[model samples]
Target: MKFKNRRAMLWHFLKGNKRFFVLSILFSGLVSLLDLINPKIIGFTVDSVIGTEETALSPYLESLILQIGGLPYLKQHIFSIALVVLFVAFLAALCRFLFRLFNSMAAEKLIKRMRDLLYEHIIYLPFSWHNQNQTGDIIQRCTSDVEVIKNFFAEHLTNLLRVVLLIVLAVYFMSGIHVGLTVLSAAFIPVIVGYSFLFHHRIGESFRKVDIMEGQLSAVAQENLTGVRVVRAFGREAYEKDRFEEMNQKYMNTWIHLMKLLSAFWASGDLIGGLQVMLVVAVGAVLTIRGAITTGEYIAFVSYNAMLTWPVRMLGRVISEMSKAGISIDRIAYILNSPVEEDPEEPVNAPLDQDICFDHVSFSYGGESPEVLKDISFTIKAGSTVGILGGTGSGKSTLMYLLDRLYNIEPDEGKITIGGVDIAQMDRRYLREHIGMVLQEPYLFSGTVADNIAITQESTEMAEVRAAAKIAALDEAIGKFGKGYETYVGERGVTLSGGQKQRVAIAQMLIRKPEIMIFDDSLSAVDAETDAKIRKALGERTDQATVILIAHRITTLMKADNIIVLDHGRIAESGTHEELLSRNGFYRRIYDLQSPEEA
Candidate 1:
């Protein structure tokens, strides 16, 4: 649940693949060792076989050569030395292949694990977190930031280890020829590393800026696509285009600036590396002429020096790029660190038949914001219908949200209970499973009509889907479609009319047949006759369920057993229709406006 650092977090996801990762590093070291042997073979051939001089093989190497017929045999068949070099090259190539294969496999597995964890965490996170964060920014972090971390582990980290090992091994072999030249070659490494450290430290801030700008640009584009209809309705094509272009230009400029910084660092590294090589070559020529070292030794040392040059130079760039990964890791860590919604330690089960009570409950959206609901007390008895009438911002929806446990209420503020048990102590999933709600704005996935209707059920039964649709007054409209229940709804149900989408959502909740049903102004889009028919059908079908209806229409609630009127976060009036009409209160006024002929 808690990771000590970014590497710890990565390792957690890579637990099963750690063996492959270790093998890859070991193979990389093997490849470097095989490569280092080639120059030594070339030097030995030059000294003993090609030139008129005694062989200078180490004791172990000399014993091995004797087994293959000694110096005389090598001199007679010179191609044998070529064959030796080819054999070493072949092993080196094989090791390199295995190294890459293992690293790729580990990297891909890490990526899949990371993506799965991020998505699962996002869905389980508290609703308030989603309301606070931008969709595009979160998506970018889940995708782009995750990729950066993967590359860091699979490529950058591996390469860092490989380069360091190669440098250490090369220096060890070069020291066998002359310690002075090896020291000279290694002297520039610290300078390159130190300079690179400082440069990357400064460049990290720039990379963060570029990453944020990219997320912002992506958000603008995403918002535009999602609200394409609104944009066209307002005739704001040119406005949206200009806005996007401005963000695009800003994002481009930030990346260009980052590239400029990278170019300067690379150019500086190249200059230092070039000088180091020049010093090595100049000193080796002096040592050779003065008989301090042999021509063969001098040639092998320079070859080793050449091998180390690029890796040392690349070390600086790798360190710099690694800093970018740190920023990405921190970004990903933010999501992983956020607290998930927690269930009570001792959870209570929701009763199948019970009264739902809101006992002096009040709520706010937190952080010094004004309260949205205040001192709200109401009760819906078992197997009864209750109506809620309120204007916009009257907290009708917020009240239902509390009952569903979408948001929690503090002990000091109030409590809601079901069947004499506090709802807060109930398991959230268990509580919501028994309570069905149809929201004011319905969202449907891209699927067939039957698929949308039966989404809440574990298995789709065509009969039940059609039956629910009939109760919601949606079956006839669905039948008219070319494919009927099989027709695709498109993204967010863009293919369906507003009335049809609401009806489909109603059908979805109806299929569940929950103990408590809440309709938060779910019938506003349908015509009066269709609304009445659906209400009539719901009344006949859901007689045993506790139904709480929130509607602005007086006609919708006039026939309910009881109705409560809300105004400005408080209950303004509550009574049956005839009782409120006798009192001439807020409910009576609304009834008058809705039915002036009867009034």
Candidate 2:
């Protein structure tokens, strides 16, 4: 995944468009050559036809003119010479158009390829990478950094080649007129290029600083928008506004400073280029007066000098802008270089049946963090219902995460098996598809209620969706809305209450009819009456599937066939509700606290 240089990395994405890019450059060279010919043609017409002397022409060109009746025919039809100039101009314009067209094709294709790769890579990255990286920062790199690279190829890189060609061709033609003046005009090129290189090298760190600041500003805006409800509930609107304004001002200041530096570089380049032009014009005038070069030759020499001036000047700016592209490329490279989660080469397709076992499994969040689940062991029999009861930070959710293989455990630590086959050997996708989990805080995409419920199934039946809604006790509440199942749930289901959102999530999972269904404190937001109804409804439908329920309510777990009570990342008790009550352990204590009358 390591690239030898930024160019190599960019080329990895752009190589597919190599033919088009090469053609663009070739057309650009042709355009430069045609442009150079116009000035020479003008000089020839001025000397041979308009001036007091006849200019020497190439033998072939001279013979062609003689065949056309020599100077007499040309003098009578002076517009013929004008027609020649128009033809050369027309060819140059055509070449310029072709160059631009091909360059655009190459640039757009490269952009599309790069964006597709980045998006695909990001989604496949391990869950831990997403947790460690800020969402806004990653978004900035994908958008702004990608744009910088696109401009580098479309404008800076192509312009660099075109400018270099112009300079080479201009100097070559000027040398034919007077070697001394060509050298004098070309001397400023090195000075301008070297100064620009040094300036760009120093400016890179500043650009990076500005880029980082912009990411921070974007993150602030993203966070504020996502948590607008929380901010309003706490009456922190003023505080949020002040925080955003401060960051925005800082971002603006950094960009202002960078722009100032760029302006300074441009002004300095203009000064040097202006002086070089003056030197060329003055020296050519002296040479013409002394008869060292013809009047026509001097005019053409000045024309070539003017042609070279802007490109050499622009060459410096292009190089400087190219330096900015390097920074952007490095930023994008960081994402591309990160390794994605690897799936087994030859995965075992184990049927999700039989017992699920956690054989002395131990896990931490990695590094020096304390273990979240320590030496845990349990088993849920096939087609049985198991309830897990625990307080906050009791490793209840962590255990389920391991079962689903969202995070893998080290081989030496322990292992989980489904149907007596090590889950690690199974394909992650296949394993997850069979295990349906409704998270504690469920997230719903912006869609209609029916759309959210049927999201797991490609082709959804309204009858089946309504049945799942009834089992989760969400049918009546949805019916109350004007649009019913078609109601649009805004971002993250913000339009729904906490309990309604949780029930919608339950309906979503129930639609899949997974082999193993897990409810991770999913009913906590609903009232006790609604909770009892949901549990009763689910009990009837999920008899054939293995079910694991994680709940804090005593009433919710007391009906379970077996129960395990967790305390501080360890199992404190395990038995049926009656057996646990007899022991008077953590389970009994929790049951008493939730149901004082029953206790």
Candidate 3:
């Protein structure tokens, strides 16, 4: 889904929970109205009941007072006036409670919807999008940036509404006592709000810089943790520590600078608020002395003026803090706005167990970069084993990636077809499910050995897990563990060796029983003996399925039905193992170097 603007996005997330906020606003307005009643009550008590002055109350209030028995009864039962004040306070507190309850419910729901949508969108985003983005930055957007938006809605947005209502209502009430004083007090509202807006506007770029630095800091920590093994092996602990410390120091300095500006803004607000309060107090006293307003009216006007001061100033703080949300929203929008991987409206479900052809295929990582695979054309016949041999950067794995649609082969560059059906026309999910390609660096989630093997299935049977493991030559190693198939693999299979992790990945793919399987140097971590066992098992078991093996080792591919040599992203040679050796081309030279005595 795409959002036209930040407001549109916010409104979209607020859909289901808007009713809660509506109720919250109703209660909040009631609270403000309730709060206005007490000052009036205090003024009425002081003037009409205690002093010998007539009440200047609204007709509704006067009728109610008459119902309770006139001024004579109120004067006789003075404590009843205190009781009325306490009663109004109780109602105000109740309304405030309901307001908070409803507001909290709305905020929680909003946050949940935002997080769920973000996670779902990120999961379905194209692999190319993920490749171009950093894990740490994406994590920051999903987590920290999400929290900022939550605060924006839950605190600043709601509070801004409440405070603004309070300020307006307070001014309205104060005007009932003295219009000139009320006007003078309300004039400060715009000045304070405008000042805060301008200050925050200037500081917004600073906040953005800090946010970017924070993501970088997270990236540094994530990268270090992920490559801890390498760091330890190289004894680069001190270097890594220094690097992290430097980044952390910069992050701290940026935050400190922001806090200093925040302190200045708050201090300035307090000074302005104090001046406003002084002017109201001094003017109310002058009016009282001149007999222009009663002492009771002066007291109530001062009370109402004080009410306006804080919330008016708070209006500024809220507006300033909310500016941060704009930055956070844009950051999150970058993720939500990205188009997800999509298939054709009518995707084809073509049979995968047939000739797979790469026709004049050319690919570059990015369009402008030099090609990784240039004009590569080949065909893998049905139920046949084909071996791809190449050194590093020879487009060995790139070919398999194209076939599986992990990366699309451009229409102008070429197209890959399975059973004469373009893979692009095939449902991406269906294509990937049928073609299993294990990478050189295998990643295992934190789980038991059996759990990792049966990950593809929602409900697993121990029998199937063991069968796949046995084929991958992992059953023996698993049996040796004290917990056997139930043995827990630590994060990324850190508890297991490299060879063990690769075997687990192999078993994972094997359990799916895909029609087309590609091992992209997945066996590189294992010894020759284990490699031969796994390949032999696959050869016997997968006779009816098509298999493509990618490896740098000659012995691994020597027995395949067909061998294709890749050199610098082009097809160097293609034939049976013996046929390539007879021709004495690039494949023959690689064979001679690896098996010199045999050659």
Candidate 4:
């Protein structure tokens, strides 16, 4: 859950492809050796080309090489130095190519796993968490934030390691040429690193601002796309365009700020590196002209100094990259590791015979707002039908949500029970799986009619699917489509009429055949005749299943075995429809308001 250490994060990624890590280290180490050899080869080439008899010993390689084999061979047929030089250059290029190829593959594979894991985590997060969080913010964290981390893992992570390796190799050879110069060049890098850290602290908050801007952009994009119809219908294109431009400008400003600071870091590193090169060249050139060191030695020292600059420059770049990556990592990890819907870890089924109770249940969306549903108690025996009628915001839909355990309830409150067991004791997944829901607004995925109806590939038979469709009065509508059951619906079933979409949503639930069936104002889209037919079919099919209906129309719920009329968050009237009507109470008031004469 906690990525407290860098090595651990790296190790987690490496676990995905241990072979790649092995090759990365192997190739980098081999490349370091070849890198160290380049300067030595150049130094010898200078001596050999000039036919110099005296050879200056490398302090680093001297202990290893002269201790084993003497430099006497350099005094003889030194023509072999060219071949050695070519061999060193060849090995360096080969190792670099392999290291780059393998490290990139490793980063890509690691990122894929990370992205999937984060996506799965988001899916499991509770409704409450998502409600409080912005969709655009979550989207930005998943996309752009993850991209920065992936880029770091891909190029910069290895480059950081490569730079360190090159520094070590370059220093050993530089000390061979001139120890004083080696120390002087190496000392300036830490100051550059210190400056980079200073910049990180100064701009760390700006990176967070960039993330915020990205989220705002994402929210705007999602809104524009989802509500395109509304915007166009209202003729607000120019207004929205101006608004979008404002959002874009904010995003552009944040990006420019980050770029400016990063540019300063890059420019500073280049300036120092230029001066370092000039100083080292001046010192090395003087030694060569004074007859203390050969022209070849001087040239090799210059080459080594040039090699050393890359690592110094890499230090600046790596720190900046990692600083940004750190911010992104923390943001992403926070979301991916968040607590999710608190379902039972190991799920079990509820008893089939027990009554489903809503015991003094209460809930609120957030803040100090009054509860959406107050302390209200009710019971539905197995195989019974219950109907709820309420004005808007009277908690009709919220009541149905409790049966599916979409919202967590306090244990101290009156609890819902299936048979004798409490609903909260039952797993959230099990409760949802066993409860079928059809919302007021139906959302159909972009898939074939049959595919949408049979959401799960398992337990879906063609005959059963068609049967369910017929029960929901969707069979005739499907038949009219060009491809019938195979017809592909566009996003959210935009191709289908509102009534047809409702029927398809009903058909989907019918295929599931859950223990608790809820129609939350689901038939409001259809005309009275179609609504009646669908209700008749539902009553026939779910005779033994517990049915809960929330409706605005009197005819929709006129046949309910038990009806509860709600005012505010409490039950205002509860009885058989006729009994409530006969009492001349809240139910009658609704009947008079909605349908003066009941059909």
TM-score of each: 0.93, 0.93, 0.94, 0.88
Location of the lowest summed lDDT over 10 successive residues in candidate 2:
590-599
The residue ranges of model 3 lying beyond 4 angstroms of the native Cα positions read 205-260, 492-494, 596-599
Tell me which of candidates 2 and 4 scores higher on TM-score: 2
The clash count for each model shown is: 0, 0, 0, 1
| Residues 468-524, model 3: lDDT tens digits | 999899999999998898888977443898999899999999888899889999898
Instruction: Please estimate how well model 2 matches the true structure, expressed as its whole-model Cα lDDT.
Output: 0.88
Tell how far residue 340 is off in model 3, in angstroms: 1.8
Lowest-scoring 10 consecutive residues by lDDT in candidate 3? Answer: 590-599
In model 4, the runs with Cα more than 4 Å from the true position are 1-14, 56-81, 191-222, 245-269, 342-348, 365-367, 457-459, 492-494, 596-598
Clashes of 2: 0
RMSD in Å for model 1: 2.5
Clashing pairs in 1: none
C-alpha RMSD of candidate 3: 2.4
Global CA lDDT of candidate 1, please? 0.88
TM-score of 4: 0.88
Q: Model 4: C-alpha RMSD to truth?
A: 3.8
Alpha-carbon lDDT, every model:
0.88, 0.88, 0.88, 0.78
